[model samples]
Target: MGLSKRNRWRTLVTASVVFSLVVMATGIALANITLWMHANPTFVSGTEKLISNFEKENPQIKVELVVFPYPDLAKKVLTGILTGDVPDVYQGWGMWFIPYIRTGKVSPVPSWVTTAEELEEKFQPSSLGAYYYKGKYYGISAETNFWRGGLHVNLDILEQAGLTIPETWAEIISSGKKLTKRDSDGYIIRAGLTWINQDNSNSQFLAGIMQNGGNYWDEQGYVKLNTPEAVKSLSFYRDLVLKHEITSLTIDMSAEVHEVYFKRLAAMLIRPGWVVSIIKAQYPDLRSAFVALPSIGPEPPYYPAETGWGYQVPAAASHKEEAWKFVKFATLDKGASRAWLTEAFLLPALKSLEDDPELLEAEKLVKVAFSQLKYGRYVGDMGSRERFTQIIFNISQEVFTQKTVVKDAVAKMEKEINEMLKEYR
Candidate 1:
């Protein structure tokens, strides 16, 4: 009897193990498909809602979102790509995608994208034009921003100086001189105008170049940094300190330039449109106005430097089709795009949503941002963009700090940029 009972116990244990294995296999086969996505954390809540809605509608597809701080997301994604553990979809900038594209790590937008002309018609020219690389589309614009180079003026300060908003570079210099203040020892007590002394100095320099009817690159993709137009642009920027004395390196190297403006130590600043929101939020009582950067030359077409971010799918994505579906749903769907606009205050990339009543009702600064979209020109979308910008920034700093002559500075920049472009050739 004892032997029989032991035999029965062994039989029961073996049967239970077999049943568990069968159940596990079935569960694996029936599991929901998960799509991994990464993006900046700014609008995670809205994105979560969109994901939830998508899952409810599709029922079989699940989306897993990983949010990272904007500054760190690129590095995180690049590491993931190396480890072959990348998300199915991720956020990227126009220039940031170039390295990935060169490695064949990024897939072009699905064949459904059809002709390039259709894409231009479907999205805003500047926003959609950004993602076109080497005759193919690799991504879609998630948000369009056109506030590259604008003059942010403290209206009260200008009024106190008995000046009106200036429309030309000469007028700005004239006004800036009067608005500038000095101490008894000839020290700069207040700056009349300032530029943010950060990476954005590249955009400011580019705006000057573009307004002077020059571009960073020619049709053959050569660096034009030392051209006559570029020299004029860089010289004008240098003279704002060394010649006109309207601004000083002491002010630029001090606290953040916007902070200087907020403290009423500066009468005007040349920066992007987003500064309007910052000023409004931080100093509501301070009167301010926004205008296009004054023309550096007499020209019919003065372009504003344009920059934006977008979404792309990895070529190695395990769920390319499903990822494309999500990308379409998130960026092309009216509700999803509307959520981005209403919640995150991003400018709409879709042409259809440009005139939406809801967007029109956004902050005055946002409306002003939309108005400038027509003048937007792509900036820093080439390969090695960050390195190029750093080089330009350093050159500008040398001029600003009186360490190098403008002629010498542009020549050095031209040589370095040409060497940098050789890899592309």
Candidate 2:
């Protein structure tokens, strides 16, 4: 009798615990519970607001966003792949995720959602190429970028000098010489234009290379940094800084170039369309106008396409079916796509919204960006993009700093690229 009584008590306690767990889960899901997710460093001030709006629309799914820094995203993602803890979805640089793709680690997207033919028509060829590899598609382009680096001219400075927007680089160079001013102690108080550091974080100098009809990669897939065309491109800018008063190197002397435009220290400088927010925020005093990147030579048509990042899904995604819904909503939603482009300050890489009113208005500044997609070349990036960029960055610096001959830079670049390609190819 004593043993039977103890068994009943144990059974009663177990049933009570199981009942509580079920009720708790039901309440959490039915009432409100966040779906844990992660995102890249792509959004600006209104990221939370956007998520809140998304939640209001889809009350069943609450997104808890963890935005990673751009520089560190690669390492974090690599770890997640190893540990099998990646979030639902995340954004990545367009070309940088090439290596992760080779392991069959990304979710295999079904053809019905975004058929291959439809994808081709939706995005520009170059944007489509960014996500395609070996008959498989790992991701889709979320934004478009190009290489029309232009001068963001401070209107206040132009007005002060009684000047007008310049049409060509020659005019800008001459005007720069006139606009530059120095203190008696020989420190430049301001420059007509500033040469912001052109290494990795920004590919500003590629505009010159493109204008001259020279490319970073040669026909045989070798680095071509020291080519005659490349030398001329670098020489043009070096001369401006080292010899002429047309421009100044930004690392040491300039204020945040974005902020300087408003402060009037720089009449014009080479930068992307995306910096407008920072410029508007930090220097509200400045009025500005943009002109196409100054032409380099008379004959060759060279406008490098803007290089934008992309969003990708991991092969190890635990809930790929659910994850793709988020990708579709975030990257392809007609309403969301337009809003994201406006909020994130980028060009739409999707096709459905070409006539989208909101995207049409905000992205008007980058109307010339798509033309770059035609002549744009991304080396080794369809699979090994990071290596491709690193090699170019190193070679570019070598040429700019006068450390290595173009021939030597090209040779070194070939070795680096081939090594990186060996894994993906």
Candidate 3:
């Protein structure tokens, strides 16, 4: 009886092992059937075309696209990434990539698949830096943007006032006094320029400081918010508001804030390329134009601290090879430039695209912004530089609000920075 029971037990154990393998394989198959993606909720100009084109070629891959408003997307994407329920591929900030690098979840771009030399031969050196880590590539390169935020001057209004776009900070201050208009009722009948704030729609402060030869952080990456130079830049901006372009104590935070730009009531604004859309929409009858921002206490040959907004891949993607295949088909090789030049307005990061007669021959106006990508900046890959951006914002708020003067702001910023640096150091 004992010998017969042993044989029966062995048979049952063998059956259990076979059942487990079947279950595991079945689970993987179910997971592969589902692919997910998300974008900022409302489909805007460039993003809409990208999604449509990516889907057209990748029809076999079922992508479940989710859209959240900008605020909701930021919160949800952050939470979702940490919890490990991340999408196979997603759109995320290029600056915040360092944290994701630590989790060992991100897939490195395979060296054998595409050599670095080959990539460099094709694309601009800077855009590739966004997706690179410690000299090795991580995320797939999508597109590039410029950091040329400047006071998009309303030349129409300036001309009406018999003034020209000011070349220097002193000119800006003087021109504002001449151009500013008001009524006896204390309402701005027609303002010389608009005072910019630290609002969501605009983060022109960083670029403004840069334009004035002021550096955001030292080489070691400590916040030097109170540098004599940065302070001078901010002081000029402050004066522009308090002395001229003075509006109500409360800012007009509406879709129409941009409408103010087109009506030519406001003379100058530190805005981006997309501001032209507002001009076309609201002030169709008026002519709008853009120019380089004024320079001051900052360095010469001005550069706006550029922040790249592009596409990235999550480490959680099970089929990285296939995912990369899709990315390459959409964002790399001839595919990347061809899609952008033909369907979307994005200047291709690849150098080869510059030679593309289609891109070269396309419209004339697009070329101006497209060529500017060559001078754009890329945030460093070192430590959590993004966490450092908050340090900047905090010190900036204090300085702007007059809670702390320039010198104190820099010292306070350095102290706070060293505290944060201890972990990395």
Tens digits of per-residue lDDT, candidate 3, 93-163, equal 45555566555666676665566777777666656665666677666555554544545676767788888
Candidate 3 Cα misplacement greater than 4 A, ranges: 1-45, 55-59, 163-175, 183-191, 195-221, 224-226, 243-249, 252-265, 277-286, 297-299, 304-307, 333-348, 353-367, 381-387, 421-425
Model 2 residue 23 lDDT?
60
lDDT of 1 at 407: 84
Give the better candidate number (1 or 2) by TM-score: 1
Candidate 1: tens digits of C-alpha lDDT, residues 165-282: 8877788899989999999999888888987575557766676788787877777777778777888888878888889999967886788787888888888887665566566556
User: What C-alpha RMSD separates each model from the true structure?
Assistant: 7.8, 7.0, 8.5
| Comparison by lDDT, 2 against 3, better one | 2
- Alpha-carbon lDDT, every model: 0.72, 0.61, 0.55
lDDT of 2 by residue, 1-425 (tens): 35587798998999988766766555322223222223423364445655665655555455556766666777787677667778666666666555566656777556655777777777755565556768877777667655345567777777688878777777788777778888897766788886455331225445566667766655655445546666566567656766676665543235656556556677787666666545545555667765566457553445544335556767666556555665666666677767777664566677566566667677665544433445444433523555565666666566556787655765575577666766654
Which of 1 and 3 is ahead in lDDT? 1
Global fold similarity of model 1 (TM-score): 0.79
lDDT for residue 178 in candidate 1, whole number 0-100 = 93
Q: Model 1 Cα RMSD, Å? A: 7.8
- Winner on lDDT (1 vs 2): 1
